[model samples]
Target: MSTDLLQARDLTIRGEGVTIAPFSCSLGPGDRLTLLGETGSGKSLIAQAIMGTLPKGLCAQGRLVIDGEAFDAADSTSRRALWGRRLALLPQEPWHALDPTMRAVSQVAESHRHVAGRDRRAAFQAAWSDLTELGLAEAGSKLPGELSGGMAQRVAFAAASAGGAPIVIADEPTKGLDAPRRDAVVELLARTPEAAGALLTITHDIDVARRLGGEVVILRQGQVVERGPAQQVLTDPQSEYGQRLLAAEPSRWPLPKPLGERQAPVISASGLAKTRGGRELFRDLSLTIVPGEIVGVVGPSGCGKSTLGDMLLGVTRADNGEIDRAQGHTLGFQKLYQDPPAAFSPHWRLSRLLDDLVRRHRLDRAAIPPLMARLGLDENLLGRRPGEISGGELQRFAILRVLLLEPCFLFADEPTSRLDPITQRQTLELLVELARERHCGVMLVSHDPALIERICDKRISLEATPSVAKRELDPVMA
Candidate 1:
């Protein structure tokens, strides 16, 4: 008989007086299981509970057995011993998971030392090979700040897979990755062995689940609403929640009508060029945005989409380019990054941050409460800091703050890249409604084609030019 690698029996967790219902699940050796749910639907909480790191005020009652050994939750020593060696986890946010100050080689090597007892030299050697295998050939020696979102996530995968843990739990491992990179990450995780163990992935992307070939456990609110083969459940779900979750993605929605003749371009770029690391990322690229228009920018990993967005936001300077905006118009930009918590000052409370922005932007105080409510944020949460909230909640607050600015142009870069399906749909709908109401032009940068198709009036794919010397081609669409 095949032995079960991980098993959770009658697991129930409580946080702040709210209880997640009792649930049971098991994973056999070499098995793959997926936990699907909306944002804040107890999926991640379940993973944390299993890891024995449930936050303060949260209580758990369950029997967690891993690799023939029963977990003793009350014993911190035993938990730590088993955490990275016997069982490893890849968190939802790679930016937060990695230490910003440390180099990639050091981080991955540290995992080896803690888990496998490798020496510094051996750890570095192993990390380099692992990173190469994960398609991050030059990832080592670079700090987390230097890597792009996709590259950072790949490094996190390499670290998690090192030391040969018996069980690996990945929460949204593909977050912030483009389509090709997403596929590559999923494929690598599915094929990588974990010291002869099993894999449990928590994600809302049905396509990812199907690619990994896992048994699906759909959670709604705080309970498992359905369980079946990943393909079967995704193709023909039985539960209403499952159906709704599948239907939430706008790619499945009908395409929007094309724009008719417009009076004037809201924003325009000419002869745009950005250079980094002595290399031309993009050259002579130009685009135009009209009022009520949503233009999506998409490309493969390392194609300079974020660089362009940063240039537009005035966060980064372009090597050569001329950008024009309508006079007397403020740029209302809200970016829902792959990791929202990392974007804000951790020392400040949410209320203080919002209040400061409101005061500076001269927004009406009366509009705050209703905006929070519209975004599904509680008014009471204003007092809480970003660390106290989930990623989805923080993203909502960020977007709401931008909405309050009421700028003529909005730049949203991967706003829903880290969100679950339900939250992704809700955020997109909210953006559409707000843009229409304010007559704003939105430039959305994303790697997901489905997202581009859903909300964008037009889409452009950016490619890195062969070199900066070729200026005759005129990369901009003037």
Candidate 2:
């Protein structure tokens, strides 16, 4: 019996007139592998090539064989025939994977109808149950626009698992999710070897590679620089590039320094009660933020963390509550969104946006480079649009945009979740340092308990998740 289920022999891919050196790898039945690299390193490109969806002008050259049949990656007809049976792609960007107009449940059901050949009614039935199990039962009726980054991520996962395709390639599957949610993703992928056949994950998150124990391949500039057992490669890398990559992974954050004398509250709220879509998120919630103090807000998904941030910013009104502000408080509201790319205009060049933000805020232009450098961003990123950059890079840029504003209160929602470990540490450090130096009040809304404990002066947790029956029953009528 042949052990090789899928094999790529000397595959070379070229995009935008640049060539990636010939690379090769194989996956037997029940195999798992990961491709790790930074932005623009051709990790996604390789997946696209394998899925026969490479962008126009990109060339994939070499021999690919699956189940003893030669695979021509450039042939769309052949790919279409194979997809959802022998092959499938779990796209890195959920925003790109899902349809904006359709309800999330319908999209997943669509996956079932197309891949599993289920009848429409059966597909919808299965989809409802599947999404519910993935923690998206309440999100079934939501259009992609209405779902949060994390919510949409779960929707994508449900869709990917619907068909049980034999070969699965998931790209940055856990980028927008919290620890528990992402761990669930890892567990699901870990089981694919038996339920499906092979799993290939593409991510910069070293934790994912570590958790999904299997072969590890490090990609740099489109070349496979290192390949070995996951434990060995991640722990003691042989390649220089691999060593640098391993060194960048973040460890537990250091406890924050001692704080000074207490200050009066900058913003205070009491007896806050909020209900949305006829479902109560939280009730009798109270919190305060004082200058130079960091307040951590945490809870599980659908626990009103982001909603609380909105309420604090005065964008969402509480059904019953009074929020008091200190007299002459000019430093009001600024937000570092979880999905940074979604916040910016895709058509606007980074240069235009950054320049306008800096000049509008009277920020020193010279300080921009050093700030970006601290976050490991390239100055040249300014020339491109938000869609052209990587998620991690876009996140750092988003932080820079807000920091330049120098708001009095910063509602940072999952600010560091999208970042790699090393960059996560640096970004959080810089944000807190500047917040303290400027006497700014910060509310860190996150699901990361460790991070909250490490830096927060006082933590207030909201803990109530309305069931799907209440929220997903009827759309909020106009």
Best by TM-score: 1
lDDT by residue (tens digit), candidate 2, 309-412:
88888888888888876666454578889878678988888999988877776677887888788777777678777776567778888988887777778899
Give candidate 1's total backbone clashes.
Answer: 1
Alpha-carbon lDDT, every model: 0.76, 0.77
Model 2 local distance difference test score: 0.77
Local lDDT at 185 for model 2: 85
Compute the lDDT of residue 347 as modeled in candidate 2.
Answer: 84
Instruction: Give lDDT tens digits, candidate 1, residues 1-478.
Output: 4388888888888766446899788898778889888776778778877888765567788788877888754333456667778788888778768999998988888888777888889998888887877667666878988888888888888887777788889988887777777888887777634335689898767788888876999987788899999889989999999998898875786665555566476678888988776667788777787777778887766677788777776778888988887776754544445457667888888889988887887779888888877777777667667766556677788788778888677888777775678778877877877776777788887877777776677776776454423222221122
**TM-score to true structure, per model:** 0.91, 0.84
Off by over 4 Å in 1: 72-78, 192-195, 258-263, 330-334, 380-383, 464-478
For all predictions, the C-alpha RMSD in Å is 3.3, 6.0
